[model samples]
Target: MSTSPRLKTQDTKARDAEYQALWQACDRASRKQEYLCSHHEAKRIILESACHGILDKRRGQGKIMCGTSIVSMVHLHLQRDVNSRLLAEARMSRFPSPPPNDMPCLANPVANAGNPVGYNDIPQQQQQPQRVSPMISAAEMALRNEVTSLRQDVSLLRQEHELVVSSLQILTERVAKLEGRQAVLEAYPNQGIEGRNAWMLVKPMSPRSQTQGRDEDMVNKAADF
Candidate 1:
């Protein structure tokens, strides 16, 4: 029972890895863009390189990639990358920098660790603007997607299990009736009380009945004893 969902989760991890690879590929493409003109083909070429770039450049080019898709993916990746950088720049610019002669503000005015004060000790406002990684958000979104897929898979599995249980219950009823008729026919001439009893004895029983009449003789003897 657990095997199904465990497999699904494992599959989900694989799914997550696939997207991660794409995102990583996209990031690599965005950074190593060969052409500076924001050319779609250029971005696609860069991304394709990340995936198939291990080969010699000439050989890699010879290998045909589905460029339209690559361009679309890289375009989105770079767009997000640019957007994040812009937002970071906007935030950094929001604050005015202190004059060169002014004392830099420090969150920890006193060096508690005995470390000397330097730019490292300065507050974030005074620090150089760093590119905020979009990976965290991308990972979170992927996790949500994975969880959603897992739920869907689990739900379908549960429904199938329920259907199977119900189907078996129905099939059991059908088999019991059919087998009784078969047993009676097999005992043609003696298809009376004895044949009915034999059919009842041999045919399948439901969970509730548990073949209560099975081994009746032994049970009776035990009771009497």
Candidate 2:
């Protein structure tokens, strides 16, 4: 093996060792999976992997760095789902199963004296042994898993997009408010502090210089807007 490859292998192993605790916690997610980390950390890891020719985005693959510590796009929704399922199971176990209702077969021939027996009157639940759940083939199961994974990814992306849009809207509203205030300043030149008597106490500029200063300030403020 190449010296660089050997070094990279060692580095990957070391990073894996650092995240052993995270993996162990994911084995039994108490609240949620710790797989998703901060963007700053993701960028550092991604850039480093790219430097080492490990970020293979040329071909269609599940992850850019699957075997390494650089799992930027890795969303462990399955782990969290499994944890929730287990928790639900535990909660369900605490309750006793409800007894089968001894409901009278209203459609029974005997109920109406000479009425014909309806299929609904039959005790199908008691007669028929509980049917086992449908078994999924390997291919179908694989497809289902892939679909689930894609759904989780889509959900995560949508959440991020919503947050970005909300932040942008808030920023735009703030800018609009600032622009409205600045418009008032631009509308009335005489109302400005620079032309007031108190302005002389701060900076006693000549009339020409004061006018020029005000013009420059207006230009700068408009440019900012």
Which model scores highest in TM-score?
Answer: 2
Clashing pairs in 1: none
Candidate 2 lDDT by residue in tens digits, 1-225: 467988789777756653453343332221211222224345334334442343343223433233444342223434354476587567545544455666655565565655465424335354444444455553564465556656767998999999999999999999999999999976654532545554444443356556455687887788999
RMSD of each: 21.4, 21.1
Clashes of 1: 0
Question: Which window of 10 residues has the lowest lDDT sum in candidate 1?
Answer: 63-72
| Tens-digit per-residue lDDT, 5-122, candidate 1 | 8877877775555555566555544543242335656655676666544233324456322223444555677678568768867865565444444455564636566756533433
Clash counts for the predictions, in order: 0, 0
- lDDT score at residue 199, model 1, on the 0-100 scale: 59
Model 1 CA deviation exceeding 4 Å by range: 1-3, 33-41, 48-75, 88-225
List per-prediction Cα lDDT, in the order shown: 0.58, 0.51
